[model samples]
Target chain A: MRGAVLHAPGDVRVEQLEDPRVVEPTDAVVRASATCVCGSDLWPYRGINEVTEPTPIGHEYCGIVEEVGSDVTTVRPGQFVIVPFIASDGTCAHCRAGYQSACAHRVGVTGAQAELLRVPHADGTLVATPEVPSAELLPSLLTLSDVMATGWFAAVAAGVQPGMTVAVVGDGAVGLLGVLSAAQLGAERIIAMSRHEPRQRLATGFGATDIVTERGDEGVARIRDLTDGVGADAVLECVGTGESMDQAIRSTRPGGGVGFVGVPHGVEITGRQLFSTMVRLHGGPAPVRRFLPDLIDRVWSGTIDPGRVFDLTLPLDQAAEGYRAMDERRAVKALLTP
Target chain B: MRGAVLHAPGDVRVEQLEDPRVVEPTDAVVRASATCVCGSDLWPYRGINEVTEPTPIGHEYCGIVEEVGSDVTTVRPGQFVIVPFIASDGTCAHCRAGYQSACAHRVGVTGAQAELLRVPHADGTLVATPEVPSAELLPSLLTLSDVMATGWFAAVAAGVQPGMTVAVVGDGAVGLLGVLSAAQLGAERIIAMSRHEPRQRLATGFGATDIVTERGDEGVARIRDLTDGVGADAVLECVGTGESMDQAIRSTRPGGGVGFVGVPHGVEITGRQLFSTMVRLHGGPAPVRRFLPDLIDRVWSGTIDPGRVFDLTLPLDQAAEGYRAMDERRAVKALLTP
Candidate 1:
């Protein structure tokens, strides 16, 4: 099997590796049809998060199950499925509460960039589609593994509802999809804060009613100016940086909510700041498994096209190029085909 | 008029001051029937929050309107009213949305321990009672001005729902009332975190089903052990400190919420900590004005008895002793009367 491995900061390589197999009864070996470079992957690539060893990378994946452990009941060989970024036991208290990402017995699915990946908690973490679809639907289905579901969680966590004014901070794939999620949730107005032309256009295409080409305090000011000085009703914070988080909080109304899906990086919030803003804060590693079923349905029904975020596509052998493209901002997201 | 003035930290004096009058068209002068010292007052009295000069203090009062400016329509002379701690114009976006504490035209009410208080935005800040009540109801009604409403806000912010497991941190007047508010909101199991026997009794009387006598990590462990390790569904943070905030966050389930109403004092939260908790956080100064009408009705109807929190009483001239008692934890709360 060929998998992408991180040797050091800014160094990712696709090389021959041992193939995965179902070692546990609750595990499943997935032959990944497609995988992608996630924004979180850039954390170590940029040296912000440490890369101590040559670690297998990639967590987003959707494919056909090649084999399953004896205990796996919901998914079987030949079934098309989406594997959540994190595996969760469905019966755990947190998983029962729809927070599968925080499940008591959880496992991180790594090395999905490989030809075959082993996903644990098969019945609880794998959601199979209703039969295999055409080649084109694969990209959209793949996003449900992480990015799309994460965007949906951001909107849901922010309490986005019909007739709400929403602001999204960040221009990444997740942020773009957040605009789409807010639209699906019936947000009355969507403001996308992006400085890049390409991401801004995608934001508009995905249902952003307005765009503010600003960052930091200026971005907050622009959002406030657009919302009649009342700030947004709900804000989706897709970038997990301190500046983006601050902007998201300040851009929301007193009773508004900020659903932050960005993995935090150096973001420090003082009690007084959060208290004074009076904005509701909720965010974390999204429980992507919880939304997989519905998201698969939406993708199958052609109700949403989240796959458009894949602006760059590469063969598994060019995995290094995929990482380079996304890291250099040459592509919104790089999708890799097995 | 006799008023309480803080000349320095720990130095509260009862001194003769100029009589208050309706200064603005939206102002009303109320002759206080009762006033009380608050936990927040101890911030400056204990020198945690700096006190710069001789300033009139006290923000909780229930009184009879002695006079009203021409613009004051909702409240009139001779009517008994509960003045919210912060006066607000009811028409602002935040106010109309039920976050009066964050109202654009908000005015902090001070000098309430005096014979008369000049309340701004009278029409929006004062909730008139159906009629003047006996002296016994004064204590409870006065609580609506601040403490009681703050507790209610904490519960509301935490989104207390029927049959949910709830926890209240801080056994002060607000935390105790939070227990009562949670009960009124139909929480099935209420855990009151307290070490003091007196406050524990008050908390239990206010509807706490369990008591945790630990603090910090031990307190979090106790709460987890009590809830089958699932944590509470909703937690009311009545004390604003780094320790209390951390405990409240850690004591909630992944999908749970923390409603914090404590005035923050040197509390800083790292993004990594909050992000990992996966708990919703909502809180601030209580929009007491928004809850005034409902809280007053609850007090008036004998549905709640928040007044029991005032364990000590003193004449207006003994304001200094009232502050000292509350500051030294000799009293849970102190009632001041003319």
Candidate 2:
């Protein structure tokens, strides 16, 4: 199998690797149908997050199961399934609480940017579609593996409700989908903070009622100005940087909630600010597994089209190009097909 | 009039002060019947929180309205009322959202240890009882002005539910009443984290089913050990120090919440820990006014007795000794009478 491996900063290659097989009774071998480059992947690719060795990348995937372990009963061979970024045993206290990201026996699903990948805790981690999805629906179904589910988690955690104003910080795929998620949750108004024209257009297409081309304090002021100086009812922090997190908290009303789903990097919050501002803070690695079933239904019913986020697509052999496109801001996301 | 003035650390004095009068049209002059030294007061008294000038010390009070400005309508002269530590205009967005402590037109009610207090935003800040209350009910009613209300806010923000195991991470007046608030909110098992025997007794009387005598990591471990190693469903952070905040966060389950109401001091939260832990954090200066109506009803109906937290009493002129007792931990709370 050929998988994308990072040898060092700005160095990615599609190299022949040993094919994965079921190592445990709860494991399943999936032949990748679709995988993508994530914003989080850029952290290491840009040399911000240290990478000590040549590591296999990618954690999101939707594929057909080529084989299943003997003990796996819920999903069988040839079934189309969505694998969450975080694989869980499904029976742990955290998993039972719908926080599979923090499951006791959690395993991060990596190397999905390969032709074949092994997913552990198969029975608990994989959500099979009702039927084999057509190629047209594959992209949207693939998003359920992480990005779309993460965006949905941000909205839910922020307590987005009907008729409430919302603010979204960030212009990436997750941020764009957050605008969509807030719309699905019945947000009355949504302000998307974006400086790029293309991302701003995508944000608008995904249900952003307004856009503010500003950064940091200025962006927060813009959100407040739009919200009658009271701030939005809910603010989604999708960038995960200190600036984005600060903007999200400062853009929300005193009693409003801030749902942050971005993979945090170098972010530090002052206890005094959080306490004095009185905003409810809820975020972290999204329990993508918990929302997989409903999200699959939404995709199947054609109720939402999260697939539009993939502006660039590449063959498995062109994996390096996919990473470059996303890193250089040439694409919102890149879908790699094997 | 006379009030407790903090000239420096350990330098509290009962000094003559000018009488308070209704200055703003929205102000009301109240002749205090009961005033209490708070945990927050010890900050400046101990010099942890700097005091540049001779500052009037108390913020919690229950009194009879001696006079009201023309704009004060909801509360009038001769009415018996509880004045929340923070005064606010009821019409602000924050107050409308039940977060009066963050109200746009907010004012801190100070100088309550004196013979009279000028409460600004009287109509919105004062909760009048049904009628003149006897001395027996004064202590409990006075708590509604701050401590008890803060504990209730912590419980409410933590999303306490029936049959859930809750933890209170402080042994002060606020923490003791947090046990009571959790019980009133239908928490089935309440764990009060305390090492003091007397405070533990008060906690058990307030419905604490268990008491953990450890602090820091050990305290968190004890809470986890007690809750089947999964951590409590909700944790109330009634102390604002970094240690208490850390313990509260570590003692809650992955998806649980921590309602912190302590006045934060020198605390910093790393975004990585919070992001990875996935705990929901909500807290601040409590919107006491929001719970005033219901709490007053509960106190009046003998549904709760939060007044038992006041273990010491003193005449108004002996305010210095009241501060001394609380600062030295000789009293859980000190009630001052004029």
Candidate 3:
């Protein structure tokens, strides 16, 4: 199988790798139909995070089950499925509470940008739709596995409500989808803080009522101006950096919520600001599995077409180009068909 | 009029000051029957916070309304009332949402440790009982104005559930009452992290099922041990220090909530840890006005006696001693009879 592997910081390659098989009782071998480069992959590619050894590269995918372990009951061979970014046992206390991302017996399914992948806890982690999605809907359905679910988590965490104003602090795929999610959640107003023309246009199409082309203090000021001097009722921090975090905090109302979905890089929230400002903060690895079914339904019903985020597409053998395109900001999201 | 004034750090003196009068159309002058020292007051008294001049120092009080401004409609003259520490116009959007502390027309009502104090937005800031209660209930009712309500906010924010394990981080009146609040909220297991004998007893009396004497990492480990290494389902952070915040965060289960009512001092939250751990943080200056009616009813019916926190009582002239005792940790809370 061909997979994208990170040998070190700034070094990514598409190479031949051993095929994955169902080694665990709850595992399923998936023949990936579609995979994509994620924003998180840039962490190590940009040399911000250390890559000590060659490591598997993607975590988002939609695939067909080639084989299933004996313990996998819900999904079987020949089924088309969307694998949530996180694997869960489905029976743990946290999983029962609908926080499958923090499942007690959870494991990460790596090397998703490959021809084939092994998914653990298949019964809990994979959701199968009644019909196989066409290639035209593949990218949109693929997004349900990670980015869409993450955006939904940010909206839910921030408690976006009808007639409320929501601000998204990142211009990446998740942030763009966050705007869409907030709109879907009935937010009266959506403010997208982005300077990039392509992202700004996508944000507008994704239900952003207002666009602020500023960053940090100026961005917060712009949001406040649009909100009549009061900050947004809900803010999604989709860029995990000091500036982005500060903008998120400052852009939220005193008692409003800041849902941070971006994998934090150098961001820090001081206790003084957190308590004094009284903004509620909730985030982490999103419980993507909990939201997969509904998101898949939305995609299937054509209510939301998250696939528009993928401005570039390539074959599995060209995974390195997908990474490079996203890294260079030439594409918002890149889809790879295996 | 005589009031308790902070001339410098560690210097609280009962001194003569101008008598308070209705300064606005919505103001009301109240003749305080009682007031108290708060844990937050010690922040400035301990020299950690800069005190520039002789600042009027109390924010909690219960008193008789001596006069009302022309615009004050709900509260009239000669009515007994409990004034929330923050005076807010009940008409504001935030106030309507039960976040009166962040009300648009907010007024700080300190200098309550005096014979008379002017309360702004009297119609919305003061909650009146049927009539003046017995002297025995005065202290308990007075606590509802701040500390008690703050504790209740912590519990509510932490989302305490029946049969769930909870941890209260702080031994002050607020933290002790947090244990009581958690119990009232139906948490089956309450852990009060404290080393102070008096506070520990108070915590036990308030329904703490366990006590952890350690702080920070050790404290978190102890909480986890008590909960079978899963950590408490919710943690109430009543102390604003970085250490207390960290302990509260570490002691809660992944996806659990940390309701922090503590006025954050220097605590900081790293984005990486927050995202990986998946904790929800909620807090701020409690909307005491929102809970006053119910709490006052509870106190009036003898269901709760939060007055137990005030171990010492003194005349208004001896406000200095009350401050001294609380500053030295000799008293959890102090009551001053005017």
Per-prediction DockQ: 0.88, 0.89, 0.76
Rate residue B33 of model 1 by lDDT.
Answer: 97
Segments of candidate 2 deviating more than 4 angstroms: none
Please provide, for model 3 over B1-338, each residue's C-alpha lDDT reduced to its tens digit, 9 standing for 90 to 100.
99999889988999999999888999999998889999999889888999988899999999999999999888788788998999999987778878899898888778888999999999889999878887988999899989999999999988898998999999999999999999988999999999998889999999999999999778888998898777789999999988888889888888889999989888888997788878889998999999989998899889999999999999989988998898888889999998
What are the fnat scores of the candidates, in the order listed?
A: 0.85, 0.90, 0.82
Worst 10 residues of 2 chain B by lDDT: B108-117
What ranking of all candidate models by lDDT puts the best one first? 1, 2, 3
**Candidate 2 lDDT by residue in tens digits, B1-338:** 88878899988887889998889899999998999899999998899988899888889999899999998889878899999999999999899999899999999987788788999999989999999999999999999999999999999988899999999999999999999999999999999999999999999999999999999999999999998899999999999999999999999998899999998897788889889888999999999999999999999999999999999999988888888898888899999998
* Candidate 1 residue-wise lDDT, A44-148, digit = tens: 988989999999999999999999999989988999999899999999999999999999999998888989999999999999999987899999999999999
Query: Residue by residue across A1-338, what tens digits does model 3's lDDT show?
Result: 99999998777899999999889999999898899999999989888888888998999988889999998899989999998888999988788878899898999877899999999999988999888778788989999889999999999999899999999999999999999999999999999989999999999999999999988778888998998777899999998888898889999988899999998888888887887677889998899988988898898899999999999999888888888899999999999988
Better of 1 and 2 by DockQ: 2
Lowest summed lDDT across 10 adjacent residues in model 1 chain A is found at A215-224
* CA shift of A105, model 1, Å: 0.7
What TM-score would candidate 1 get against the native?
Answer: 0.99
**Clash totals in order:** 0, 0, 1
Question: Higher-lDDT candidate among 1 and 3?
Answer: 1
TM-score of 3: 0.97
Provide the TM-score, chain A, model 3. Answer: 0.99
